[model samples]
Target: MNPRRKKRLLFASVLIGGVAAIASLLLFALNSNLDLFFTPTEVVQGREETGLMPEVGQRIRVGGMVVEGSVDRDPNSLKIAFDIADSGPAITVLYDGMLPDLFREGQGIVAQGTLIEPHVLEASEVLAKHDENYMPPEIAEAMGESHNKMEYSKGSY
Candidate 1:
């Protein structure tokens, strides 16, 4: 092959490889920035697997049972505080927004926000389990019970 043609081919190959590398890097960065929510059980068991606890101001989701009698709202500020519990520890969440219709004390909830403190989550979004069978799969698995076997209504609040 001619020297000039060989040089041109090598340059093209390098360029293509560089583009592919850049594309892969961009994809990886995007994925890493997209935060995920986890139940308390999941956070306790799989923090290493799921990168890290979101830094302050970084968005995240947390799921757990709403602590009974822990839901309180500030009438003027519209800020709400509730406690979320797993088998191990409970996380206190402060949210400033309208909660979902299903959100209530003693219900399963997934709150999305940033961790302002180690055990305090400042939630911007709150999703409550809709019904007895409405638990997220991850929460159900973490709780070690199949959704089919658990009757939400049977539990006496």
Candidate 2:
């Protein structure tokens, strides 16, 4: 091959390799920071992918309806604890921060943090649904079949 063609081929290969490296690095960063969202039931039952309860201290997300009558707040501190339940199971969450204005029992929410135990999560952040009829899609999917949304909606739950 000609000298000019060889140089061009080498440059092209370098460019492609550089692009691939950057893409892989980006993917690695995203995967590391991305927390898998789980419902209380899934956490209780254990993850299908791993076939085991998440290790204690591994960061993850848990979302579900805030169990009715489970809210407890401290009189003098920001500490608040509540149970979030899906269709079949519930997990207790402990958070010490100003809760969202919309946070309440019977509402859908997501808690981001690490599992403190098999059925407890230490939440670093809590996210409530933005509006009525706006449950998170992951929670909705997890709650189907077993969870009776209508019962909860009718003011009975």
Residue-wise C-alpha lDDT for candidate 2, range 18-125, written one tens digit per residue = 999999999999987988888888888887877866768789999988998999999999999999998877899999998999998888899999899889999999
Query: What are the per-residue Cα lDDT tens digits for candidate 1 across 42-137?
Result: 454446565555555656788878877898889898799989876556788998888888787767888888878767788878888877557787
Q: How much does candidate 2 score in TM-score?
A: 0.76
Off by over 4 Å in 2: 1-28, 49-52, 145-153
Residue-level lDDT for 45 in candidate 2: 88
Instruction: Please report the TM-score between candidate 1 and the true structure.
Output: 0.75
Write down the worst ten-residue block by lDDT for model 1: 145-154
Q: What is the TM-score of each candidate against the true structure?
A: 0.75, 0.76
Which segments of candidate 1 are over 4 A away from where they belong?
Answer: 1-3, 10-14, 41-58, 145-157
Instruction: Give the total clashing residue pairs for model 1.
Output: 0
